[model samples]
Target: MSVSPRRLRAGALALATLAIISTTACTAGGGGGNANGGAATTLTVNTSFVLKTLDPGRVYEATGLTAVHALYDTLVTFEGSDVGTPVPALAESYEASADATTFTFKLRSGVTFSDGSPLTADDVVFSLNRLKNIKGSPAVTVSELSVSKTDDSTVVVTSATPNPNVPVVLAMPSTGVINAKVAQENGAKDGEDAAQGDTAQQYLDTNSIGSGPYVLKSYDPSAQVVLEANPNYWGDKPQFDRVVLRNMDVQTQKLTMQRAEAAEISLDISGKLLDGLPESLQTSGVQDTVYFLFLNADPAVSAVTSNAKFNQALRAAIDYQGIAALYGEGAAPGAGLVAPAFPGTLPEGEASTRDVAKAKALLAEAGLDNPTVTFNYPAITYKGVDLGTVATKVQGDAAEAGITLELNPQPLTTFLDEMRGGKSPLGFTPQSLNYPVADSLINNMAPGQATALRSGWTVQRADPAVVAAGEQVTETLDLAARATAMQEWQRLMNQSSPYIVLASNSSTVVATADLTGADYSAAGWQVDVAAVGRR
Candidate 1:
């Protein structure tokens, strides 16, 4: 349900104790009043693996993105589920070079950070440069680009290559502009030494300085985060006076929401939890993430998995529809490498149906007799669905095709280490992208990329046709042409690749029926906290 961007690997957190829940119920409940005796509304959101960091340049995890998104505003942003289009946020307007190599932005006038400092082009330049130099997980988002200030209200970004998605990249939470003066005073640095010289993470963990709707009031990585409305916010005032995000496990989340405990909204909820849900709660979702199975192609790791025919057999044996059914509504059989929410995906019916006969035939053609393989996966629940449960289903399906799978479930951290080190011959995990762009997904899954390399599929060993198609997609500048290239790439990948598309689960959010505007988006910030309001 999350990755390295929470993209390639999802992290895990221990379940909160019942005492913590009781404490949260007392402190973070909704519909309360302030000391002045006036109505003060608070929205409580339940989620796990949050509060990793508040620094925008370093925040890449799903929940971390959610926090940074509220505290900071990016130059461009996706509006209300329209992730395909990027609109100005901190920037009033922007222009891109015809070749798509350069972009110039005009900062919105009269915007102020939480500290009441005027927004300046220097802040935008400092933020982007610091993001690149921090060498954090999110730094890769701007690795190919350079940013500079041209004037007090103008900033320029130049790319090393034609990048039609630069605007979309700017919308990423990692690019959120910060108050440079305050950040510098707190030890934030720019240039190549920022990875070591930047020391503002600790300070930023509890303090926020941005031109967004909410400001950080308190942060406790082990418990919850508190936010208050920013009085100096330049945009529409938020309806809620405060918001609280609590860290709770999936079962706890389900229990809390179903019982109307302390939270009004729940994140990372599985579709299975929606069954017989009370009418007092409403749900909204989008198919924003995919769980996939990949077999390492490195012969040194596993000769059996390196076999092309065996890979084909494994793909054929998987019951894609059955996996989708596990998540219930809002889930679907994954059609290609890309998640279903984005464009360039294969049509729904195009996914291969389970064919036991074909799988057995392929295995026989590979000259393997009842080949036994180790299927390794994380032993944790992701977005309410247990990975072990999914792995068990896959194991059973493989058995039907005359294959034996020795399921090895490891802790999330250990599993991630082994997977990233290419030690797992066969692995099952979910990859969630930082942004909702087809090229970002393609680049991550393409040959010689992060996902492929993690699966031991390097350019030297990858199919020339598939590699060429991926290159074409990245090199194309025109949107229509890029889409065509992406399609061809997926076609070739499906024919022969280490990864198999399994199921795309919906990014589900359940909110109290009294709440309105709890919309869903495929972006890093799954739900726009600033937009939620009581009916």
Candidate 2:
């Protein structure tokens, strides 16, 4: 999920509480093209989140992924907001081996990078290899796939196991292709080895070296990112000549949109805030992002949280409906790790419901009565919701079940650092889907995966059922079979209760009355910047 500025100085949580009471307000109208008149050549977007990096390899956050989608092209892409199927992008066509262990892509002819350099299979090989070799947060997605150039126009990716979700995985922003010549000439040092350090980290953080619709004109980590249309782009010209991504606080974002200083505001806004906006500004349908509470199960790090019964007690104690109400309209209690918008997601069940008596009994069985646990969350709001408020609600609910939660709110960067390093005993965080496949959820929760690590579970202690179910989802190619596998996997995960899913809130993008075609991707975190335009 995207990280926003720190909470308001005072009374922010109180405002959140009041906002939940007014969630029944009417939904905002849809955006149209230049309803106010006059053509717009440049688009200004104000957001609460700041950019982490411009480099495709290092960018894994929601805000960074939005910029990467506009500035880079992958071998394949999800077509027309549908992430369930992959379509040709840089690659004209692709084929997978009968055993599903090897996949080949045929590059499109006459394609060139933003720098005017011709696109080739060598570039694809270099980009994919560099992605895995870099060993960044996104590297885990393709760590098992080996890339090799078959010729100038053909590239082959081979896997040690029979993995069938290569196409969907390739469509991810992390798999974006970069100009090999430009990168190597600038600061990219190591060839394909993981031992060498990445020298281009700093340079790529501010530069663009890809074949996408936009080129990075200027970038300021704490301010804004300016992107100009790529004249050498092989696809249709972007409707806007330039795009500006401004970093601002939630209040500032609201003020800018109200003053018409920004054409669009792409941040998570509460329903109350949306009601306060001028009717001229329209809101798109909710996007797919889920908010949850993760409990660390590593006894070495947190003895209290590691107790299975304690974890289950905490999960059962949460008021899922009340928390969902805090998000207002378009938000619902989460059914599982995967959002309900996507295919193969499990059906809504009673697993996440509140049961104070059961929770107390479970806590007693674990020899914990009125025990305290440190609950950590970012001091800042995530997307648009106030996580601090959510954490407070969790504390209140857990208290009803004879548990005391000590709230610890930290700055965004510091909170993420501690959470990633497994220093937090329990964390309140949100996760946006990376892709539409059920395997995406599996990749995050299975043994040695990203989410599992965040919850302080190492490969040695990961539940074998999760590992086996994950393998089943990846090894089976049939969609129906995968759905069944995912259901079973979700069931086992719920029983373990490493994380308690509170709600899946809709992602909203507010735009000026004139701006139109600001379509959302299937994952709902990214917008089609190239498709957006003004009258």
- Model 2 C-alpha lDDT per residue in residues 1-535, reported as the tens digit of each score: 2211211110000001111111111211111222223564678776655356667776776567778888899998874345667799999999998787899999999988887889898888888888888888778778899998878999999987777778877888888898888888866643566437667866776678888888877766566667778878898888787777776766777777776734565554544456567766656544366787888989987888999899889888989989988876557776677766566666766437898999999998999878888888888765556788889999999999999999999887788888888888988887765556656677667767876887777667767877788788877876667877887887777777577788876655666766666544654235778778664
Model 2, global lDDT: 0.73
Task: Go through the candidates in order and give the clash count of each.
Answer: 7, 3
> Residues 1-535, candidate 1, lDDT per residue (tens digit)?
2111111111101111122221221121112223123577788988875446778989877777888888899998976555777888999899999899999999989998877779899999999999999999889879999998888999999999899989888998889989999889999998899998999987777688788888887777678888888877899887787888888887788778888833388886756766766666767777777788899999999988989988999888989889988877678887776666666666777876798899999999999989988999888776657788899999999999988999999987788889889899999987666677777766667778887888889888889999888888888888768877787888899888898878887777777767766766777787788888766
Relative to the true structure, how large is the alpha-carbon lDDT of every model?
A: 0.79, 0.73
Q: State each model's C-alpha RMSD to the native.
A: 5.7, 8.7
Highest TM-score among the candidates is held by which one?
A: 1
